[model samples]
Target: MEKKQLFRNSVFILFFLCAAFTVSAQVRVSDFRYIDNIEGYWTMKTKLGLYAEKWKRVDDHTWKGRTMRLQNGDSSKVDDMRLFLEGDGIYFTIAAVRDSVGEPIRFKLRVLKAVGFVAENLQSPYPQKITYRWKDTKHMDAHFEGKDGRVSREIIIQYTRQ
Candidate 1:
């Protein structure tokens, strides 16, 4: 009976330790450091063509990026983006080349963690929420969700580090 009790106690203690470790392993959003992980070239293939997105650090607190199509060894710019830390939070903006007015749609970073981040723009007509999740160092997923009129839609893109 003593040996049986000892075995039970050991199993219970091991389970408790595992639960504690799992709870502590979750990441908390403290700052924008995780955003730097995306500084490089990323690519995704679509039915239209192969598209690429490249990111460059403008300063310690800002990054500039552009999405383009790779065709016949030439690239056409689709959208320009800027991500920066401002006033204790981070913001993301994107401007399409056709928008000559130079106003970019803006999103505020609402959720940030070691795994990824979520940004939302309630005023945007299309995508009100944008989420980026890292599968690993070489792969990431981008999700855009919003409502167009009363219809809801979502787009998910998987990007490979290039």
Candidate 2:
């Protein structure tokens, strides 16, 4: 029947459009390194803690990132960390398991308002209420506070594009 054929055609077209949209949303990971020629591993000592690791571009807009602490030198899992560009800015998320509390912690870094980067919720007591600030690519200055209105820690991190 004509109606049946029309319905089938509509479904096919819809499927094609959905597939195209999905592909477009997936950014290639390699494009990240092109930003500042930032490739390889680097480390930084922060007042909150010490972080060391490598951040390598895997494909357009996506990167393979990992971090470890200076105290024990236990390396973080690469699969747990990802760096990518969203829209005009770059962002990174590091998912770590807290050793002291045995809960999952996430450190999120996002570029905020013009030429500024915000490292929020590095190690947050609550999910939404966390630290934030503006920063340069090489150095970061921010403060983290707890719910009790006390300064948890202040961090100054220096980064090198390795």
Cα lDDT tens digits for candidate 2, 1-162: 999999999999999999878744443333344434334555576564556656566777677756566555554443355656666545555465343567445444432333333434535553322222324455332233344335444434455433
In model 1, state the lDDT of residue 90.
82
Deviating ranges (above 4 Å) for candidate 2: 1-37, 44-51, 70-80, 85-90, 97-116, 119-151, 159-162
* Top candidate (lDDT): 1
lDDT of 1 by residue, 45-117 (tens): 8777888889899988898988899876777898888888877668888775112455777788877777788
Candidate topping TM-score: 1
lDDT: worst 10-residue window of model 2:
126-135
> What is candidate 2's CA lDDT for residue 161?
36
lDDT of each: 0.81, 0.50
